[model samples]
Target: MSPPPAESGYSLVWSDDFSGAAGSLPNQSKWNIVSSGPNSGNQEVQHYTQSNSNSSLSGSGMLHITPQHNNGQWTSARLECKSSFQCPAGHRLLLQAELRSGTFPANQQSGIWPAFWALGNDIRNGNNVSWPQCGEWDIFENAHGADFSLGTLHYGRGGTDHLSKGSARQTFQVESFHTWAVKVNRSPSNWQDETLEWWLDGNKFFQVKGSDVGDGELWGRVAHKGFFPILNVAVGSNFPGGGQPDDKTTTGLGSGLQVKYVAAYKSN
Candidate 1:
């Protein structure tokens, strides 16, 4: 079935419309399945897979990506479009998505990490020598905290050298769905100044003043290039602290992340 007519006053620039192809991916034209854990900095223990079994649209506008426990390890699906479908650079853009925690949820602190975000459009070709410098926009990231999620920006240097522009906590009722958004723009000097915000059931909750893109030069320079979107659910990582340090692999509810759909709009 086709998507409902685009909402009045809002043009549908891009959408996954989960109303079609339940149990199957929409199309390569919309999303490129990412199959690896190398770019996943969270130290998550799940191998990203690209198959209908791992990611599919279920009827009623819901997409399910259950991380499965197989071969003595955990594996799930991750999707990206680094070079394939780069978002127009230097334009104010919004990355939004409706996501739900899996059926057999994994909230083991050290387990169940799901996120909706974007990266520099040139990351696939090795253009991003340093993150955040290359640019990253995390719209919504949940760490299994009773009903709270996190929004953050990591750039300049990786790990300890990394500088976070801002971060916030919001209580999330995962049993239901919510809309998460990240608005980004750059200054004349090419520094990427961004704003992070979100809501549960259309109720405002999380917001933070994003990092200043052009304020400093200690870590080279920052640009206002827009990045493509990334949707994934990982096992565990040092970033979303709360998990057991000893548990290095993904366990608990095998099924990983579930996404209803994703969209983006240019801020006029």
Candidate 2:
């Protein structure tokens, strides 16, 4: 499938349409299969896996991150982009994706959570700077099989505690594809004045300026620093649900996270 067109003054920087033979793994050079404990450990019960059974190409230009339940364990998939992207000085950066919430009904999706988000590259590259300080930007997140989604920004002075800004809750077609995006604007004359905006299906729902953070230094670390993308389905945690997969939750594709594409654009 063709990638979505960039904004009039922007050009494509990187993208993946997930076009390939069905069941194949994602392109290795473009993504790293994360095999870990619930990705940052959110009290989630699923362990991300490297198996195609968990994450694979749909052969129809889509990527599927499915979660499976076994004899007594739950397993899922998580992928991190191999590159870090940022809004260049005097320009802007757009991170977007086309996603659908599987085909399952919200009520039966107990513990199901899917998201498209990013974390500061410092943490990805093991730069030694810990979380919160490194920053986190959540472009889209749906939990507990809810009918709505959320967007958020996380940053602070460097510790377990952090400051966060969340977008207004918005509902969308539960099982249909929709565009989710976040744009980082760096056109401000001053580095401390950059901003981040969140959009859902072309509608701007939230915007936050660096000044809103109150700490110029903290804002710079989140707004100006390079960040990489992440796609994963976690099964319950401190997230909204606060519950794990129950008997009501179905396993397999019906509860998976489907993505048509993931792309980044830089304003010309």
Candidate 3:
């Protein structure tokens, strides 16, 4: 994927254009298709699977993570990057994706959660660790098919005491492609003053500085460590207040999350 428009100084460090044959899974070397080991904590209702029915390539340059209802149960897919990524001390690291949600109204989309986010690389198998402690950056998050999207930072500790802040919700047209991105700019001489910016369709809507987090260690969890990208579409989860899909909820491809591309860049 090319760097965001006019960002000519950025060099592509990694990217996935989703150009595989129709119905194939994403490149295994670059991503892990999570089939299990989740849901217990999130209270999510959908069972994540590696089935093509849930995730596949469109052959026309797109990755589709479809959420479907079957036999009174729901299922979906999630893909996590295999490599840890971070911006260097004097540069910027940019993460961006072209994505669109399924067509449906807010009421019908209740309990549907689609996201493009990241977590610290420290979170791995057999490590037995909690989230946010490693830190998180939510580049794109939408719930209940809301007209707005949120960009949030999760730092400090985890659970009840976890520190969190979301950008002022920015309204957008859903069901159509939009570019969601986050730039971790390490331009400041002091790490505490560096900034994390959130952008949509080339327009920056919100930002937060390390000073805003107010803790060097906590800030370092996100700024100084490595993180990987995640793409998933969930249903009936904790984030949506435990709401479940009703008969009105659309299933199958109509409710899938379409991803045209995802890329990472480093500013030169």
Candidate 4:
């Protein structure tokens, strides 16, 4: 493996530099564009598109996941790195990304939600494991037009009965570039002994352990398993606004998430 990046103490494991020419799609072997329009249980308004117009690479070394109102319908993109990367237990898993978003007018920011997160890899490939049960680790999430970012963990028997913890907020706007990251460490012998730390712009904010979560058993299962990365821009969820977003609420032209780079590392 290559040496660890000087800034991070872990050895680099996987990364997407988004170095393709402008208008190019992400490497097919590394990412899978989710093409489903299921309610997603989030009441999100945007229909995820598989087209490069919604998710593409730029000559500026960035990945753009833009949401647009096309033909009176809202569309966006979601990319998952299920087939390429996985963070297993007993290792310190680190994920970092530099990102920014377009400006939102007034209270309209509540209409946009962009996130960098991860979920248990078993949820896919016919494992038949459902969400919440499979676990979710939100490394970064910006809601509405709030001047802060949030990091959270979700795991439980079901969505409604889900248990979660780890809400560390950093004061920052979506229009400006920022570095967001999270490091997860699970004990080699005891899954229950796990720690998750959150960081923004290189400042460590909060840390939580498996015991910190509401349910010890549920959170323990999540700590023991492997997870994969997901990048998406959602519109009008319960987080940003109570209802679905429409033409007036959504960003007309300059709205989307711009990711400069995404990288994962493992402790030596």
Clashes of each: 11, 0, 0, 3
Report clash pairs, candidate 4. Answer: 109-144, 109-145, 110-144
Q: Please, what are the lDDT tens digits per residue for candidate 3 over residues 128-237?
A: 55786888999998877777888999886766768887888788888679999999999899978899999999899999898899888888778877889999998876
Q: Kindly report which residue pairs in candidate 2 clash with one another.
A: none
Kindly indicate the candidate among 3 and 4 with the higher lDDT.
Answer: 3
Between prediction 2 and prediction 3, the one with superior lDDT is: 2
- Answer with 1 or 3, whichever has the higher TM-score: 3
- Over 1-268, each residue of candidate 2 has an lDDT whose tens digit, in order, gives 7467667788999999999999999998999999987644677889899999999998888899999999888999999999999777899999999988767876678888889999999885767878898999999898877878888999987777788998878788887799999999999898657889999988899988988887878888888889999999888756764577788899987888999999999998
If candidate 2 were superposed on the true structure by all CA atoms, what would the RMSD be? 1.4
**Top model number, lDDT:** 2
Better of 1 and 4 by TM-score: 4
The sequence of per-residue lDDT tens digits that candidate 4 reaches over residues 1-268 is: 2222445557878887888888999777888898977365787768888898889987778888888776767788899985434446667877888888657663655567778988887687577878888888898887666677778888888657777776746677656888888877864556556787888887888777766774666765566567788899887676633456644565542567888888888777
Q: TM-scores of the models, in the given order?
A: 0.75, 0.96, 0.93, 0.87
Candidate 1 overall lDDT versus native: 0.57
Better of 2 and 4 by TM-score: 2
Tens digits of per-residue lDDT for model 1 on 1-268?
3343343333446777567666777456667887775344555677778867667777767667666666666667777843322223444545567776644444343466677877766455666455546657676776543366766665665435666564567666667767776654432233334434444444545543334434445222323454677887766555445442234334433335666677766533
lDDT of each: 0.57, 0.87, 0.84, 0.74
Candidate 1: where are CA atoms >4 Å away?
1-10, 37-41, 82-92, 103-110, 125-128, 157-161, 185-223, 244-255
